[model samples]
Target: MSDRPMTTTPPRPPAGGGLFGRGPFAGAGMLVEKSMSFWPSTRRLMRRLAPERARITVVLVLALIGVVLSVIGPRLLGWATDMIFDGVIGKQLPSGITKEQAVAAARAAGDDSFADMLSRMDVVPGRGVDFGALGTLVVWAVVLYVATSVFAWLQGYILNDVVQRTVYRLRSDVEDKLNRLPLRFFDGQPRGELLSRVTNDIDNVSQTLQQTMSQLLTSLLTVIGVLAMMFVISPLLALIALVTIPLSMVVTKQVAKRSQKLFVAQWTHTGTLNAHIEEAFTGHELVKVFGRRPEVEQAFQDRNEELFKASFGAQFISGIIMPTMTFIGNLNYVAIAVVGSIRVATGTMSLGDVQAFVQYSQQFTQPLTRVASMANLLQSGVASAERVFELLDAEEQEPDPADPVPPASRRGRVEFEHVSFRYEPEQPLIEDLSLVAEPGHTVAIVGPTGAGKTTLVNLILRFYELDSGRITLDGVDVTAMRREDLRSHIGMVLQDTWLFGGTIRENIAYGNPRATEEEILAAAQATFVDRFVRTLPDGYDTVIDEEGGNVSAGEKQLLTIARAFLSDPSLLILDEATSSVDTRTEVLVQHAMAALRSDRTSFVIAHRLSTIRDADLILVMDAGRIVEHGTHDELLAAQGAYHRLYAAQFSGALVTDDDEVSGEEEVAGVRG
Candidate 1:
């Protein structure tokens, strides 16, 4: 392997601004700007993931039909009320009312109320009365109600379809992003936060779309249609009814403005609590081992209290809107009634007109009140949208070149030349590092904690880009190589072994899917994992719990070794491979590593000096620079940093043995 560092180029700006706004907020128009974020993620969902035609068609058809029926239904109810008044109360008609009453009823049922009103005209008609008109009107009213129900149900069905399907796709997309994201992303973000994104955030968005969004539309349409009808009846009365509209709108705006901020806080606090709970539960073993139960509980209680306070503040303030709207709506209703009564009494307005105006006033206020409540719900949805967009907008691992060209051939010669990197730019983790591992050689990196040992492996994998210099595989720049292709040819055994929830055989075969049972068994046996597998009732088919929790740490490491062996990778990295295992297990792991690295270029970051004593080359890193390099014998002869560490650990071991032997010998002599 060569010691040339892998160079990194700056990230390219995206082709277009993504769904989440990256632009500077101009002012109050930021809501509109941020709303635009909804479009990109939506468009991606529509164009890339699912067919727009299917979901869009369903939603539009349902919304159109529902809006039409929703708008027309209230007017029909007003008409029906007018008919009852004219036919039953106008002439003091009894149970077996006159032809006028029947005719009035028919016209009330139809689109036009002319038949119902005209039936009362003196000198009814030289021609016989057309009762068919009244019958048609009654039938029309029933049909409209039925149509309304069908459309409403259809709207609900379609909304549910969109919510469920959209969430499923979205979750799958998020999981894939998590899988592909660089290891550093996890370092910066808590697992719980990402989990909340997949679960809580998406669920909020889904619930909003499925439920509240349609209500908002329906309420808006109702408000509009009612106002239009009122204006038609009497513009002056319509003007009176709208007096409260502006006031109510002002009040709602104030409430929304305040509640929006609280809702955001509420959601943020919820994520914090969720993360804390998850962490607490996942580390319960450590908590018990260290007897930190009280402290952990107190921390959790503090987070819970924060969530409660935020939720109470948000919901309490948001809850005021509907009641306040209802108050304003009732006030509007009284004003319209008082005003319409005078017009009717003065003979300036007909009784029917006044009655219709009263009904229209209710229509106007009811939807307005509903819309006020929906505003609160929408605030919650927007919060979730903001979070989802935030994730989507997160700086992605910079892309490789569009037309990446793979190396003509690779002999697994790796190099790091003047490579420097840092998790944070100001606090450099690895600086001016240079190293090399020739093909078919085993190289070891040993260092104390914070010595940038594992960081070196990260550089080789290009999991992070270097601040300066270049890394190459067989002289081809790794930065120019396709990430998937680069990773496919490399195998890694992390310090913390993670086995997906699956069978042992499946986990081992993860790196190489086409491995036969025979190959898998051979790899397992080579790693000494087959000894434990044979004891299990299901043998290789035994299920592994998440992260291989069912297995001991040593066994998990052994399984990881088996997996690496099965991969047959061109380049292999074992980070702290035997650190958590016993001496017996370490020997087995070492034997496995030696067998696997026979002809492959391997880089090992080991805390145990004995494991790497036989390595072809050893690198001692400190503060991101190699201070020593050579075989174990060469480094020991040099009496450098590597020699000091080795000598210290070896001396400590010898002293410990001597003390134990002395105690035993003394006891033996006394007994004799």
Candidate 2:
């Protein structure tokens, strides 16, 4: 890190910087709504979904059977019609009626023309009407219908399995991608927005695959089957019905091309809203203390309204597909009826055939509506896939070299040789500066907020690659080592302590998962966490809830310290490690730190004036440079920046919690 003036220009922003100005979603509400074709990109998802090709192949074949049965049912019903006609003309009734019964029934209804027609036909035995053939046709129709229903159910089952496995793979890929991405990538993103992609976007993709995308293949097959059956019934009628396809396609293409833009805008604004909610709720206490509730409510209302406009526009436009297709379908039905009646009158077609042809026309056009709706769904799914792909394809940190040096016999020695770094390329924050801490030495860093204290530690740990010079561990440059290997030798306890949802023992053992019960207890005792664990009823078995909120902030800090102790790293970095503790706990923590410092080299970033008086070395920093370095008494006798800083604290102008110097005090957590 450079020790240059801290007021230099800033560094390059994060990956998503193009989306905003200063903070996340500064002007994210405005959208560029443009319809782009989705097929080319969503095709990858299609391939991804059917990774088990044979499974999807069987699924498609079963779907085809369902479609074929759907088309065949009406035709079979037409066959039953022909059988009934044969029964009427032959003067022998089907099994439900005898010729004598039919005549009497017609006479009772006072239908003389029907009674006469029944009387004129040649009466035969039950064989005259071919009731046996009709029975067989009826049975076949029932079997076909049942099989169709079974195929539908079976297809759904297999599709669900395929979809779940594919989404499982997608989610796993994204999780691994997060680990490989550079820290700067996260610095530029909102946690909630990223989380939204993992959940909401992936869910959208899953729903589309389960409910619609998979249907594309089957829908196409149904189209082919229906058209073929229509032609077989009557080619003239089939020609008339075919007009619905192109007409509906033109309408669908026009509406979906425009509505696609609105869907994209909808999802983008949703992410922005999520980002706002995440940040706002995380700091709700600050919001209430400052009476900013009205502003927060207004922001929420504005975001919601933006989302509403996009949602309403997209849904309303795509919604036109159903009604328009229905109108066209009804028109085709009328044309088929008119044309078929003329053919029947001319004796060119059978009455039953015309009825089957009408059914075929309706069946053929219905899936047009399905396809149109499917198009809209595909557009939405593609939008979500794009967001997911963006994260997966993002630039990742460089991998370890082909050959990496492993740490030999561990040493606590660390050295910064003429190091320089800047958060912003144009603005140099730290200049050529050097420091060394030998094995078992204690180095205390004290500076105003943004005076490069945290940056120094970040560079030493190789969080951000240095712009110039090198930091080494025991004479080996840290960059030459694999990052995981380099980090393994050091442990950190930050002011913002993070504890996962697990038992206290599990959390403490996180640093060394294989630690035995005895080892864990020893580490807990070393860090003074055992004192608090004893107070809790469950002790080490006590489960910590979300963010460890069940415990006090100070207790959470001690648990983290215990975690570091279990790791037993040769080097340690503590940033305000004792800030949240009470005076009594602080005494115990200091005793623990003193004991741990005997074997490990420790770097301490301190805000309290009283915490580091006994340090082996004190580095007093101003702006970004260390102006003085010596023992406590030597710095005081020299009467430099450290002396003045110490005098301010001693004179009661600076307190442990809040310090005031030159009648002004800077708040912490600021970055240079």
TM-score each candidate.
0.82, 0.87
Report the C-alpha displacement of residue 82, candidate 1, in angstroms. Answer: 4.4
RMSD (Cα, Å) for all candidates, in order, is: 9.1, 6.6
lDDT tens digits, residues 358-435, model 1?
A: 777887888788888777677777677667667776667878879886867656889888777877655666666767
Per-residue CA lDDT of model 2 for 1-672, tens digit only, reads 334444433344543433224443343333443434577667777778657788888888889889899789989987777667646555444455667887787789998665665564434325446788889998999998999889988988887888889999999999999988877678767766787788888899888878884577677888899899988878888888888878987999899788888888777777778877876776677768877778777878988898899889988898888888888889998999898877765546666688788777877887777888776787778887877887898999777767888767577798988887887676787777788988888899997777788778888777787888898888888888898988899989999999998999999999889999999999999888898899999989999996677999899999999999888899999998899988898888888899988878899999886788878989987656788898987886675677667766655554342333332222111100
Report how far residue 597 has shifted in candidate 2, in Å.
2.0
Model 2 residue 415 lDDT? 90
lDDT of 1 at 93: 32
* Best by the TM-score measure: 2
Q: Candidate 1: where is the Cα deviation over 4 Å?
A: 1-62, 70-84, 87-136, 163-181, 343-353, 653-672
